[model samples]
Target: MEDILKHNFAAPNQLATIYYMKERVEDGRSYYTFEYGLRTPIYATTSFATLQVMADSLKILQI
Candidate 1:
């Protein structure tokens, strides 16, 4: 839902995106990451509530 909403509102030919990656090492160490870009977010975490707000706001555009 979030992805579709973002793409609908994103700049032409520039869709919004979110990325996550994880890596583990032989020493049992691990890393996690989250990445996203497009609309401005009120918080760093970019929770679902924010996405819903964005979606609702885009509805005004009626695209």
Candidate 2:
């Protein structure tokens, strides 16, 4: 799992963080990549915390 933080230019004065996770398959030759982002206004601590909690609780299932 990796976390990256960057500014989001889509909206003015907004900050964004991108999270990436890679899962390898049993074959050792294949893998899966997952990415998500948290976008919020600058200094939005409550919203950022809520998004962080939601992101932490994410589950990836292969079907």
Candidate 3:
């Protein structure tokens, strides 16, 4: 089985962040991995709470 979760958040100053997660099951075992990234025009800063919220909102689909 395999599952994926993805989300994106946009902040002020043309800053954007993408969050991704993947889950896989093999041999009766489950594994997971996560990735996140940020994009900006030049330089940008965001609060930790905002990033946490974005991370918290991710949900992997069941299949």
Best by TM-score: 3
Clashing residue pairs found in predicted model 2:
none
TM-score attained by model 3: 0.29
- For candidate 1, the lDDT comes to 0.38
Badly placed stretches (over 4 Å) of model 1 are: 20-35, 39-49, 52-63
- lDDT of all predictions: 0.38, 0.37, 0.39
Superposed by TM-score, candidate 1 places the C-alpha of residue 40 at a distance from the truth, in angstroms, of: 16
TM-score of each: 0.24, 0.24, 0.29
The candidate that wins on lDDT is 3
2 or 3: which has the higher lDDT? Answer: 3
The positional error of residue 41 in candidate 2, measured at the CA in angstroms, is: 0.6
lDDT of 3 by residue, 2-23 (tens): 1111133344444344355556
lDDT of 3: 0.39
lDDT string for model 1 (1-63, tens) is 445546554555444556543333434433223344554443232322222123225322121
Q: Tens digit of lDDT per residue, candidate 2, span 1-63? A: 322224222244444443454555543333445454444643442112112223235433322
TM-score-sorted candidate list, best first: 3, 1, 2
